[model samples]
Target: MNTTILDMVKIEVTKLLAVGIIYPISDSHWVSLVQVVPKKYGMTVMRNQHDELVPMRIQNSWQATRKDHFPLPFVDQILEKLARKSHYYFLDGFFGYMKIYIAPEDQHKTTFICPFGTFAYTHMPFDLCNTPSTFQRCMTSIFLDLL
Candidate 1:
């Protein structure tokens, strides 16, 4: 990482730490490698204060997580269900997955190591192998009646 990006990472780490999103850890058996990724919009200028969000990832640990084979609705099925619908209400749950908290007993499994320090997530991040299915199940459960 270059000096500019490193500084940004430190700043981001400090912010997350202060907000109780991540906590420093001395050690863990399931530490993940941290990575920096640009958001979908991508970074336009490196110096931009609003630079894309950095996705802290568990590159190798992903292989270690058990896959949640929860079935999600197929796109064709969904479109068929709404074929004649006149009204549509799209739910934008972007970042909503973050609301799913990791159980206290299992939070340690999400530990990640970075240059700044070692830490763990308090909630489910996007990179988890089962995140999609897990998040889908959670959303479906919450909106069971509506769906």
Candidate 2:
């Protein structure tokens, strides 16, 4: 039996969910976050911070308008710290690709839509408003004793 495009998309998405790459979002609105893009292979879409599908025209607009005021460490400060250490051991967190568990109560806020269905993230998504700060906080909490 030949699987239709929707069926194929569903299969791929299901695999992603099974592996903890994504989670289901129960109370999701279609119009708010689901945009269907035309593709030959299968369904494709752009997920926004609210886990919504972003239309092409509005996607750029949204990105340009969003403001993140979270403060990052100054490069000079980091450089000074590094220079103080004679031997520096670098632990790569894969460019800050750390796994951050999402709170159960707030998981719904990360819901997004695909061609087949809606899903939420079990781990922190990079697009969240305060992801950098949140990640930094987590790191600080974990390494406080060591530091």
Candidate 3:
């Protein structure tokens, strides 16, 4: 609402755009509204190379998007599989979700509007309802040989 907050939002958006994480989208049928919160407390969010919080889009498209119901292995199942393994590999996906690319035709579904401008995600954002399954599928493919 105030000029001070508006400036901060603009700065964040500019940074994301420069990094190719988001692109200016003038028209999107699925445009979602943007709200500037002090932090990304609950949802999956990220920080740029400078460690500043990047602008994140919050869309309700998850309510309609088809879920990729890839069941995650239960802990006991995982333990059973690894019980006698000679070695184990652990990967931290702290920022891995952001590395997953979003399809060009579907990027608009993640679009959001703000005082600065309208934009859409170029990579998978973790808040999506299907993100967990999508990420799991990706990890499964990458670790298929290991498994």
Candidate 4:
């Protein structure tokens, strides 16, 4: 069964709510929110005051008053929070290795076992951060790559 992107979004949204990790990152200034999903994946979806979802490229630095990024620490917290449930949530991300898996002595790789194999974008969202005409052009280029 193939899950749509909307399905992914909804699942993530619900999981965040259940863990009580859903909070606006900045109450009066930065205007960002963090959603901590247990088990599967961790994503940060930004939004405006109107509650419209804004797409964001992943960043290297922590955005606010946190000692670490929300998703990383949140996973640990969620693990502790749901320790009794043997098969509780696990966290996955879009790219690179999560620091959570690194050993103190052998900190070389961040290899996570993905049942779905690698996470390459065969067809990325064309409308993301682009005008209609530009999106159409990108679509054409993508199609060319397919061939």
Q: List where candidate 3 sits over 4 angstroms from the true fold.
A: 1-8, 36-64, 75-90
Residue-by-residue lDDT tens digits, candidate 4, 49-141: 334322332446643222222122245765675665655433332221111122223211111111222111112221122222343343346
Model 1 lDDT at residue 72: 88
What is each predicted model's overall lDDT from 0 to 1? 0.69, 0.59, 0.72, 0.31
**What's model 4's TM-score?**
0.21
Over 4 Å off in model 4, which ranges?
1-3, 24-28, 32-147
Tens-place lDDT digits, model 2, residues 1-147: 135545655775687688786776667432235333445775454444354333222343464224345566677976787788777666544335338777877666667765567787677755565676777677767866744
How far is each candidate from the true structure, as Cα RMSD in Å? 6.1, 7.6, 6.8, 20.5
lDDT of 4 at 92: 35
Where is model 3 poorest over a 10-residue stretch in terms of lDDT? Answer: 44-53
Tell me how far the alpha carbon of residue 112 in candidate 2 is from the true structure, in angstroms, after superposition. 0.6
- Provide the TM-score for each candidate, comma-separated: 0.73, 0.56, 0.66, 0.21
- Candidate 1 stretches with Cα past 4 Å from truth are 43-64
| Highest-TM-score candidate | 1
Best by lDDT: 3
Between candidates 3 and 4, the one scoring higher on lDDT is: 3
Model 1 residue 138 distance off true place after TM-score fit, in angstroms: 1.0
Which pairs of residues clash in candidate 4, taking residues 3 or more apart in a chain or in different chains?
A: 39-89, 39-90
